[model samples]
Target: MADRTSKKPPTTRKTSLYRLTDDGDPDLRSLIRPRYLDQEGFRARPVRQGPLRGLLVTGTTAPGPADWCQALADLTGLAVNEENHTAFGLLIVRTEKHIYALGHGMGHLMIEPARIDPGFGIHFAVRCLEKDRVTKVRRQIMDARGRSDENSVTSGEHIRGFGIEEFGEIVSHIAGKVRGIPLTYTGGDAAGAHITGNDRSVKLRLGRTPEDLMNDLLAIEEVCERDDPLPEFDFITQVRPLEAVSDLAQGLDARLDEMLGTGVPGRVGLAVPSECREGFDSAETFRVRVARRTRTVPELDAQTLLGPVSSCAPGERLETLRKGKVQMFADSDAEEVISGNVSAGRWLTAEVVEEGAHYFLWQGKWYEVGAEYLATVKRRVTELLARPSRITLPPWPKGEGEGPYNEKRVAARAGYVLLDKKNVHTARLHGGGWEVCDLLGPDGQLIHIKKAPSGTAPLNHLFAQARMCVETLKYDTGARRKFIAKLDEIAPGHPARDFREPTVVLGILLKEGEPVTADSLFSFAQISLLHTDNVLKGLGARLEVVSIGR
Candidate 1:
């Protein structure tokens, strides 16, 4: 269980920590924008249940497969038939300001807006003025691929003639020789553009959380207001028509294949020369160089750049130092302290990166070789912090989004009465909110629980929420009075915990399993504790961190 009483960022202190989830909506679920998957079959379609379509489907339930069934029906006002080729739908994403959806080059917002069918293709070619005198761009690609004419330069709907991974570099190489077009927008006749590139090799979809979408629009609006007070971009974020989703998908596929390599799915093999300029001949050093040897080395450790991809084959493995002879088995190999002793020619299925050396993913964690060679490892005391392995990420709830909900219920059943929903006050940040103490006991016990699906509570965010809630209550006089009155009615003469008095809350979320994780929570807890002492001390409150099990 991870619990913290950390201080908030400086900005959180000055303004209201809680914003209404919407302009005036009480239900907070409206803030979620789910990710869409691209599995084959019905799941591949961008609409029906996909965020890729850009339709803001309104529903309370975390949008799941079944839930999407009803949402689609509601959106179309007609039956949804995946089998119906003629059955079509369009989904668009837009914020309140862009309710009318206008702006400069709003077309870029959507992956594509035209011909929402499978036949669409993204032609990833340099869009150039015929007079740029750089027809060599196409000619060069054709010559390299041993092609004759422009038609021969492309494959099917894609320009398979050129290396997809080199697209960015190619554009840069010819940037000066060609002019870039402004993608056609009013007040911005952005024309005379150089090479244009879009790929339709793989069905790709882009997703943005509502918060992210809001941030982008807010940033755009801020710039516009500073210059053009009556900015037309207020309508910028609204989803508009462009190309087809299929084209974007293809482009995405072609690009990923280029990066991940067609070798053996997830596993990549590198050969190191026994000779080096410097005397540094360690396998770890050599491996690092190869990974960085590519122009994409800056983005090494592939997973970060790969995005959501197929997991490596089960038991998949990669050997950064495989089939290579070694000087001798040492207590520590390279800069890493080995578990025991590894012999020469023994490939390291699990290795880590360190100070120009591989040292156990920085102390404790370890990543396995194979397809997952590039996975980041977050471990504490040799125990791996788990990632969400669920097929779908559950919808983040609107309330506190904390475990204290379950904790409160368990305690309530165990005889500690908690505040009812109406009496439960929250300080909401329109995006999310947190609850102070779910239930205060007659014994002056204030409880705040954190929910952790992986059995490790996330302390930082929870602490921020808890701090915001308590501070909001403390500063908001009417709210503070109302809470006290409610407490008086709920626990008459029970020595209720008072906001103006030194108070105590049992943070009963952490449970010491067979392997204790409290130490893992140490860093965050220290910061949170310092914050509570400095900030919450005036509120006459302090939280006691403890753990309990079901």
Candidate 2:
């Protein structure tokens, strides 16, 4: 009794796909969680023919109607009682090379975590696109000091662009810290392209039919096999090399264990991950706790939470403690509880080296720096060090004084005018008081000095101050005048009369035995300094970096 006139259902559907990078066929019976499979009317069967020949699964879960249905019915004075059921399906296509997962609704939750490839969608998107326009970009910039900023940008129309400059200047500058957790764009042919991040996976919208899905997978795999599509973004890469090299991966695990035993907050601290943005603004405060019985800590710092870990009882390992869940709870009626890996929350700044390869762990992920990229960064740093000191400043007194007094003493010894605490009011320029520089050289050199830091926060702050000063002086005539006026009052005969473009010297006072070299700085500090130097050069100012041993 089927009606021949009825048209066939649409062949296209929005599909969420994942590629299994591991070898061997996974046991399908054990794949889906038992709770989901135990639901009513769950069916799973094997397919032996056609393009979708693998495993097919379907399930249904009835959780009743949404809570808001009753509220909407009361307000509208109409009957709105309705039952709700979630219908999900999955098709696992096994090919000669690898396995592909096509999921619908909540099908992604069916598979266990071990079989999926991380960063697959991102790598695919970067490879297939041409040199044209990027409409959206999602990026996370972390300062290695536990603070990070995640931003998402979208365009209403396909815009013309290529590389990082496509996001414009300011965004490009901030993106200098890191690039492309996930990137979206419109290709040269003007097709809308996007790649979205999911829980431990990524999503791509593509044709759902078996044939089209197979073809797309092959094309994507071929493209990714080529060389890196974007090399200019090597400043902070997202790809994890440890995934492929088992030896290096093992070494990293051991390194993490040793560092956790030290329990030093400066070397490793904790924070709420930048990616977990749900209900963050509404939470008044966030407290972290490890074990069920351990009292919750007041803040997210490792010093406050872990203290000197040596004080722990025998047979207790911080590494084991790190595996415990970090509960971010707020004191409110909502009582929102968010949990993530304590190890992921820990901010690890030390570099890991194995077999001449370098890696950095920040906010839970490992970022590998290629040998060529490392060399280039070192060369830039060396060039900065080659610039002679503008003034013959003395070595800092061997751990004998604080920053402000030492700055004054150094300036006095070098015949430079100390501008410490000389806060200039340039509401029109920056909307608040900020120092132009710590020391104003008599010959027009702008000197900024800070003691080398155990953490990157102080160095990042120092860099930001120098950058703001350069930008404000370059653009604001009134602010420049105010600075000169303040300068005259501080040192009457100073030669910095008009405040034109001047040489900027960033001096770091190292500990007594630390030498002045490229390796003296942390990787993050070097990265920030390079970006600041580039910005300064673009504004027609020269930059010099020096390390003074105490």
Candidate 3:
């Protein structure tokens, strides 16, 4: 009799593979959705013969009208409502020490999002033999400063030329927090792998047939067994979604509450997580509700946030308030709930470098900063501290605001011209309205003063303000002329009349208990200041950071 279990011949067809996380539930039945199993033509059974020899789920999506059917109907003047079906399959392969899933067509939809390991593919890609020869790479890096609500992507031929060292330099920049989303590399005896950010799985373009898929799986398992060849890529590591509920998260939450409850101006705030979806752009205000009460606020701040959080019953934990959502509306009363939580921690700027564990919260997600990166941040802060300032101004009085202090009081005491609110308009600059500085000294010192904020947002704003003014004066002739004219108006025969390159002083007024240390300032704030320092220096102007108040 012929052998019942006959091996199928391998064919050249592409396939994608996902490794189930060790901590995730291994039962394939639990991971798959019931609706997918019930789909027409769906089949779930054990593979009788193959290298994988595990449970296989094969099916086609229920026939649906093709997306271009209506368009085709109009063009052809005939009934063109053609039905389309997507063939998909998932094979659960179990090895001695690992459980893996192979997705064919739309087979990825068969597994639960939470179960697949997010870093498995990237690990294999980095360790693969052809790691040096990369064809295409997709990277995501967020603006360290909160100036933008978008994550930028990088790709193309230029990426193809980059080696491991070049990739290191790109991610090491302080301006943004970068991550490799998906990287494709080829060369070295066989077809290469396409490592993707989607569950961090590897896609093999050459293994399309079931027999070929088993070969690819075996190759992947063998590659995964090796150690990572490039460790320099760990400048910024991802914090797993499940890990967010750990003790570190609890500490972060408590710190956020402390900052909000203390009523620090910039400690906690709100922002659009992403670009408003068309209609929401006109939203000028927000209605925040936590617990039973609601209040309207111009912008989210610590004081505004504290009210709603404090309104909860005495025994309620802050986590309970997360159920309440924030609403945004335009001119009409049609309010849309914008946020799923009111814990304030979701919007808080929490950066902690404790006991060698460095964590930064950016856009509501946590990232672990590598030791080398932490050292880089410390060096920046240290250099800024050691730089001497050419000008100094007294601190704001106990109950006075920064604007009032600069315009009303600091001018008389420091013998500096009050240039606060002296807006110089130029079409080329950032939004046009620009101030030379808060105060200008007789000796040509450009003094920019700001209250030392607990978070990076306000500090970054201050840094940008100073950087833009200097940049304007250096480049925009029209803006410089307008600034000089405004200066003469404020103080006749002012030293700025000869404003070639004045010393730019950044004066930060510290809170009573806050110290002037590297650890005291948020890491992103230091990065902003360093960036400002570099720009001002390039413009032939000296930059200095001074803590106001002895």
**Model 1 lDDT, residue 172, Cα:** 16
Better of 2 and 3 by lDDT: 3
lDDT digits (tens) for residues 392-460 of candidate 1: 111223343344454444444533556524344433333222244555554555555454322111343
Off by over 4 Å in 2: 1-14, 23-25, 29-35, 38-43, 60-87, 142-209, 227-254, 262-307, 310-347, 428-432, 475-479, 497-500
Worst 10 residues of 2 by lDDT: 167-176
Candidate 2 is scored at a TM of 0.71
Most lDDT-accurate candidate: 3
Which residues of candidate 1, in runs, are more than 4 Å off?
1-415, 423-434, 453-457, 504-518, 522-534
How much does each candidate deviate from the true structure in C-alpha RMSD?
27.1, 8.0, 7.6
Between candidates 1 and 2, the one scoring higher on lDDT is 2
Task: Give the alpha carbon lDDT tens digit for every residue of 1-550 in model 2.
Answer: 8897897864445567777654443666565567666767888788775575678788888788878789989999997877788878887777667777788888877775556665565555544433233444444344322332334334322212322321101111111111222212212223444544332344554555667566666655675576775543323233332342234444665675566556663444333344333323234444444433344543344454455343554344445455544545555432566544344235334566768887765555556666666677678777877887666556666645545544656766645877777778886644666678888776788888776535443465567667777888988887888888887787777767755677888877654536546776666566667767776877788888767665
TM-score comparison, 1 vs 3, better candidate: 3
lDDT (Cα, tens digit) per residue for candidate 3, span 318-391: 46345555555563453554433334434445555568776666556555556666577678678877787656
Total clashing pairs for each candidate: 44, 0, 3
Best by TM-score: 2
**Residue 369: error of model 1 in Å?**
27
lDDT of each: 0.30, 0.57, 0.58
> Would you list the rank order by lDDT, best first?
3, 2, 1
